[model samples]
Target: MVKNVGAVGDFDSAHETALLTATGRNQLLDAMHWIAEGRRLNGEVDGPTLLGALVAAADAGVAGAEPALRTAVRAALRSTLDTSADLVMTDGIVPPSRYEAALANVARRTASGTLVDITGSVVMAAQADDPLVIEALGLVAGLSWRDLQARAYARGTSLPGEADGSWSPSQVFAAFSVVDDVVCGRVEPQVPGAVAARPIELLLGGTASGWAAAEAMREGGVSYGTLLAQRDVGSAWSAHRNRSNNEISRLMVRRVLNALDEAGVGYWSTEGDAAVAKAVLGQRAGASGKPPGQLSIVTRAATGGPGYAVLIAIARDGGTARKTAATLLQLPKRFNVPSVLVLFGTGWADRGESDDLVRAFGGRLYTEHTLEQLAEAASTVGTS
Candidate 1:
């Protein structure tokens, strides 16, 4: 059992002694907890001293301090550490190996939501060749494109280059660029366990099977749009296609949103009647009419490449096809979009009716038996 170590002395010197002494797991945890208690008592911890001690503990293979270490890291990052002085300093108190281990332990912990704001600091402070750098790259890969770009842009001021083991300004910026490329799908993750997480993967119930299917389709060169379309394409086109457009349509709408998200496509769902009235026709389709599922999306050309604007409609077999078609056709004029896609669930244009509908809507009509198929088709058409 360890006795109360008393007040930490000479911030810099005590840091090194504690680091060397806290080699065992229990000792490391105790040291970390002590630091936490110190912070509680002292109102704040000396950033360099705390980080140096924690990093040394991590280098000793002490796993128990991971959570507390992450918290300290978050607090450290949130502090107004200088991009040059505080953030990049690795000379006196922290050696390269210890710094690397400390960073690695922090990155190993998954951070989401508001805690994610610490990303920019971590990136700015990271040294090249650190394994934690790889973990940092992985974390950014899961962020939205806009967020990724913002991160890259935030590192405007460059840190001075190091002569020895630390990362230089150019090296740090280059790492950010690589991470951005990976998120954009222009470059793939080369490191193990560095896979990017799509928004759909965050779903607890549907994640496993959905991710597996998505992976299979991705390997097959299937765009998320195409995959969604194919899923909605019912095995048989008869009664399956004609099913009522109630909860199923709502469900299909959800699936479409998810598929687009998985593909990193940007979209906004709009109430069919209102969107059409405001953007297309001069008047609402009908006040009492059941609104269809409508969305405005920018579908990716290549995986993570440029996005193309498209107006999409999810219509039922009822009398909604013509109204849907009319609304869709006018969208290009209003939104200046080049493509409009209409997904139908049963009872759309019949055999004799096909020619007229085809001529009117420019043949972008696709029949879907299920919402999954519609989603696949949307992806296919959008990508194509």
Candidate 2:
């Protein structure tokens, strides 16, 4: 049963016009072929369009329409390659943002299974040997309904009729893995969720529990997961600018957690700055989550050994780092525990004209250290 692509959504004269006017003739013909498939098979899904059903069937690994879909997708890929500015918008050769949005609209109009089907063609196109196809697919990689919502939430809004789904932190991680692999030609393209496990491990430090937390964070629509791979202060702040204070703290906490994982330090108890600041500085601490400006991880020198802790302050800019240093100086008397203050940034407070900030604050600073360096640091706990 061939499914007509037009049956799934409320298409109007304008949409048809947009699809026809913005797409090249051959591309338009290829798109129409999916509709034609339904007519040829005399098997219409009754409600949705042929393309919608085809997408569903393909994702389900239904053997009937696989060959036709592959052909149609190849044509779509070629249509994407035309580089002509005159084709119909429906052909997906327009601006990358609009192209992704168009695909998202198609996804939203279909059932869950069908949505995965639609993604297959995009994945197939991405897997092609041609550079243009790869570029186009990369731009449109966030089109899955789930990714669309995540992006929308990032921009501080929800799409119409959107609902939360199961993929989280894994979705962004999955998207990252897909794009990374495709760009590097390291692995054959696969389903976003079905990619191999190594990328996640490599990105998240190979901790099973940490991966679970990341999945939950992603599922709750938090922005922390994708931020994991960002390795510098500038990059971290750029991606984190518009997030909430708690989220900002969470992000900072995750970095510390990753660092601790690398350093082989395990925490006895952990609390974000938001919670700890109130306890350390009182309720007037407000939402700033200041002083530490991140979580304080309590640790021991060894099993059943003396207690120690690490306080982290992430300085995206110098002023923040200076104030954080001032705030951290006061914590020793209040907590009365041996602790280390870790400053994360590039040149935020490396020096002040003549004096070094690390000396004044009694803290360790990091501008660049690969993951292995951190892990080595972790292995030598209490040595220095």
Candidate 3:
């Protein structure tokens, strides 16, 4: 018997009050259709066939099977979209380009409504850690959940949940657990081919692991502040932050190197100048030691200037910018070279301080975020 497939009613009539706009709804529907079609092409039992069977079951008077068949098609469509999201988080799977575009559209729709919708901010705050929202943001922009969390933590900015009564001790434990895992090498960095890809997936997987740790702690009746007070946990987070900053700094350094190479400006590793490299390493040394790789380069100075110029990427705590600036300012006099300090990963909380440092550095300061300007400066280092 031909089982009826559940209704394929118009989306607008079905989800009129959905947070997504009409355009967003249509895009999402199209993506769902694409997924279903792919399944059909792959010889999988498509949604329609499953719905048809459900409808047949309902006609045979299977209890509770009527509603099941009534909206089986629509529900499958929605579930397919959710499955795509889940795959992104759990397996680092990227959805098809069409589905990614649809997610981007939906993210834009939600972001635009955030200002005017009464419950918009609240809803966003509540779902700040949600995997779907995280994936959606990643699709729209390069920002991943880990990037957001790192930025917030770096800047000492409170998340919406932290101030909106939604924060829980469990989240605190989870955060610490994530940091600990990173420090312990349980979550090794996987540098994707593209800088902007799959960070959200990695973060989601880490978060899942963190939640498992949190659950175990809760079962053991650990107090809220217990983990916070642990020196090892605190140190782990500090290490994690340092590592994150170092990664960003390295990327910025690569950009500067590329710019210098393109300009045919001769540059060499700081190792070429032993005294300068030793001094810089000494200046930047911390509990964990100097950052793993070379962060400074020696290049030709302007024609009428000193013999050499030093380009250095400074990756340190934001609060230490002032002290770091003071130390760096002496490089020109002590080393007899013009020093350019690129403040890498300085956060919002210390922006004013960094700006002051930049001004005091006398046109020698750049930031990781302003690579174009930094590149220009690098290119002109020997000519200007």
Candidate maximizing lDDT:
1
Listing every candidate in turn, what is its Cα RMSD in Å to the true structure after a full C-alpha superposition?
Answer: 34.2, 34.0, 30.0
Q: Work out how many backbone clashes candidate 1 has.
A: 18
Clashes of each: 18, 19, 0
If ranked by TM-score, best first, what sequence of candidates would result? 3, 2, 1
- Taking all chains together, each candidate's TM-score versus the true structure is 0.24, 0.30, 0.31
Please say which candidate is ahead in TM-score: 1 or 2.
Answer: 2
Residue 60 in candidate 1 has what lDDT? Answer: 49
What candidate 1 gets wrong by more than 4 Å, as runs, is 1-249, 261-293, 300-318, 351-362, 369-384
lDDT of each: 0.40, 0.38, 0.39
Off by over 4 Å in 3: 1-251, 271-295, 301-308, 311-317, 348-356, 381-384
TM-score of candidate 1 versus the correct structure, residues matched by position = 0.24
- Choose 1 or 3, whichever is better by lDDT: 1
Residue lDDT tens for model 3, 1-384 = 111123323222222222112113244334233333332222223333343333344445544444433333323322111111111122233355543443333334443432122123332443344425333432222233455466446545443332223544444334433333442235534575533232232332334333243233323444545434443323433433433553444444566667666766655544345556645543433203332233366554455333334445353444454555555544544344445555443331233343333333333444434444444455554452
Q: Residues 99-143, candidate 1, lDDT per residue (tens digit)?
A: 445444434342531213234445555444353453334332444
* Model 2 Cα lDDT, one tens digit per residue, 192-213: 7665333332334333232233
The stretch of ten residues in a row with the least summed lDDT in candidate 1 is: 81-90
